[model samples]
Target: MSNERLLIIDDDVALCNLLSDYLGHEGYRVEASHSAEAALQRLADDDVWDLLILDIQMPGASGLELLQQLRPRLRTPVIMLTGRGDEIDRILGLEMGADDYLGKPCNPRELLARVRAVLRRAGPDAVVEPRLFPEQVIERSGLRLDPGLREVSVDGEALELTSAEFNVLAYLMQNAGRVMSKEQLTELVLHRKLTAYDRALDVHVSRVRQKLAPLVGDGVELIKTIRGQGYQFVKGSA
Candidate 1:
């Protein structure tokens, strides 16, 4: 993990120092910023971050705001640090392109676990796994997904998807028409188990649906949520 550089954006100096020390000792090159301005300036100059740990409650330009700007540009996976019960912040963070979120007062061990999971999902190994979705192109509902290239498009027009979003869409499309249970999807796509209050899967699905909406048209239902089961990718077309 020495080659993996991580940036922590939070106003809590103590927390930053704590994580910098812990993660640094864990073999990850880590950096910290106390505000969004500093983070943004640093990002503009050096956009080579492998992962970012952002606190949603920063003093100015909240983590969600900075995330909004990084999406479709940086594509660097982000794991948001949110307050306990800040479900809204967590959801907004995911919708704004966050790969994962953890509550504050977090245990460095658990944060480290999440960091590993998110990094695994965003790294090259995340896409090069051919066993999950074969190396062939999957075409369904006029949507095309090439697992080898890790590219997706609707009627040949490409769609910009985050690493997690791409994996979510790919797995769902590869098994079109089957309802993928939350537990199964989480473990398969997120590389983690589904925990209580973990809305990550649902939010990730929603983002995938949103990105596929404009290209697939208003009537195309590429992904559908099952009432009590999970989610399914319809075998229909646009």
Candidate 2:
């Protein structure tokens, strides 16, 4: 079975069907919604979606508007579709954290190609950009994180973390200063729901903090709790 799922939201019925057929043929499990309301409903049901194909212009809520509403709540990469070839819309879309943008009346092959590229880029298993540190390193403060090796450090040493811990840390570190809600973080990092009694994330966070206690010093707090919100990393200055 294919490892990827795609959701396409567009007002054009033919375009949606065509995309659904083409992407399904390309070995992806695909779902399509013709309106923003339907799309939101689909997303809210908390199914796993690898990517979102969103149309900028629509009847109820615009694609850009939907993206604005969803970006903080979801981490699925979006490829926005715009009817007008406006540079402004393109820039705005990218600024709002869209993975890519395309104008309509484009070739189906081209759209498919863009979708493939975006999916590959967004996939966690896909090749990531080079980082400064080794794959795994344990520093004195219990901060064990190997960006390259995708490892974790603790208390000036290394910790054996599961896949979920690593992914949660990676997601938090990527948005170090931002206070992400539990729902938002769950959606963005796990791309899935936070199940009942799933204190897995909280447990991981506690472990990470404990590991780094030694290095935290007096003023250095790696992860800070935001009241009623989520967590944020207080990055230390050199």
Candidate 3:
């Protein structure tokens, strides 16, 4: 993981130093910023980080805001840190394009797990054994999904998708017409078990739907919500 550079942005200087020491020991090349402004400046100057561990409640330009600002320009994976019981922040963070999130005061071991999971999902090259997909490109209606390239396009125009969104969409399209429950989707795509009151899967699915909507047309739904069950990709709906 020496080559895997990470940035930790938080207002807590002590915590930043602690994580820098710990994560550095864990084989990552880690850097820390005590403020959002400094973090943004660092990113602007050198946007080579493999991942970002961002605290949601920062001094200025909150982590959520920083994420919003960064998404348009950088595709670096982000893992948000939020206060315990701040379900709203967690949800908002994911919706704002965070790859994953962890509650503050969390166990470092768990945080490491999440960081690895997020990185793995971010790209095939990040993990030891890459998840396999069919070699042939899948197309329905006007939308096309190229598994080999991990790219999705509509009428030859590419659609921008976060890593998590791309995985969910790929899985759904791979099993088109099948109703995949939240538990199944969560485990398969997130590499984590579904927990009570967990909305991460839903948020990711919603993002995929939102991205697909613009390309497939407004009223035509390609991914359908099966209330009380899960979600399904409507084959031929494209």
Candidate 4:
């Protein structure tokens, strides 16, 4: 039995109870909070969690708000639970540093798969190729990723990249000048295949761009959108 610590934050009591029971049976030590605010207080403690299943629609301080407040400090992987067809919330949650999002009314098994995927991404070998080792720190265009430490930095200043974001950057840097399609990124980074109208990859790329812009300054396009293709990390920095 796995001993991963899991936290679920949502207002629906029945939903919470259902997931808690299901996840608990799966061998995870699970805890539930009825509101985002209450979750925030609980999260402030020293008990670090392995993953968080956060619902975007919550009373008093939405999931997005809590995510925003926790960023760069609370680096625990987050998998948001969004209402079906809630595209905006999904994208917002990604921008807020969430590792991934799933449509609500979800099945326990599917949620378990998602949880495993996110946790796998958090590991050192997030991808299949090139392999990741303790001494293997990828460096490109002033950006650095230490797989052993699971840390990324730009120009010597550390970047607070979530697991998803770090995987994106690491893969792009490893294959600079190559146009990596959304499908490829989705599969390699998120440990899932891309679906139609899946803006999750785009939103993550956008967030990476936003975080890198200020550090690298203007006119330096490290990651470029390939327009109808995908994205590429420039072979040479400006």
List TM-scores for all candidates, in order: 0.56, 0.53, 0.54, 0.55
Model 2: residue 40 alpha-carbon error in angstroms: 0.8
Q: CA lDDT, every prediction?
A: 0.82, 0.70, 0.79, 0.81
Residue-level lDDT for 236 in candidate 2: 41
> Can you write out model 2's per-residue Cα lDDT over 197-225, one digit (the tens) per residue?
77756776787666556555666677888
Kindly indicate the candidate among 1 and 2 with the higher lDDT. 1
Can you rank all candidates by lDDT, best first? 1, 4, 3, 2
Which candidate has the highest lDDT of all?
1
Query: Once superposed on the true structure, which residue ranges of model 2 sit more than 4 Å away at CA?
Result: 1-3, 126-238
Superposition TM-score, candidate 3 onto the true structure: 0.54
Q: Please write out the lDDT profile of model 4 over residues 173-226, one tens digit for every residue.
A: 877898988888776565456898889888888999999999988999999999
Pick by lDDT: 2 or 4, better one: 4
Q: Which ten residues in a row have the lowest lDDT in candidate 1?
A: 126-135
Evaluate model 2: give its lDDT: 0.70
Q: Residue-wise lDDT of candidate 3 within 144-225, one digit each (tens)?
A: 8876566899888898886567768877887789898988777656555689999988998888878778777879888899
Best by TM-score: 1
User: Where does model 3 exceed 4 Å of error?
Assistant: 124-238
Cα RMSD (Å) per model?
A: 8.2, 15.0, 8.4, 8.1
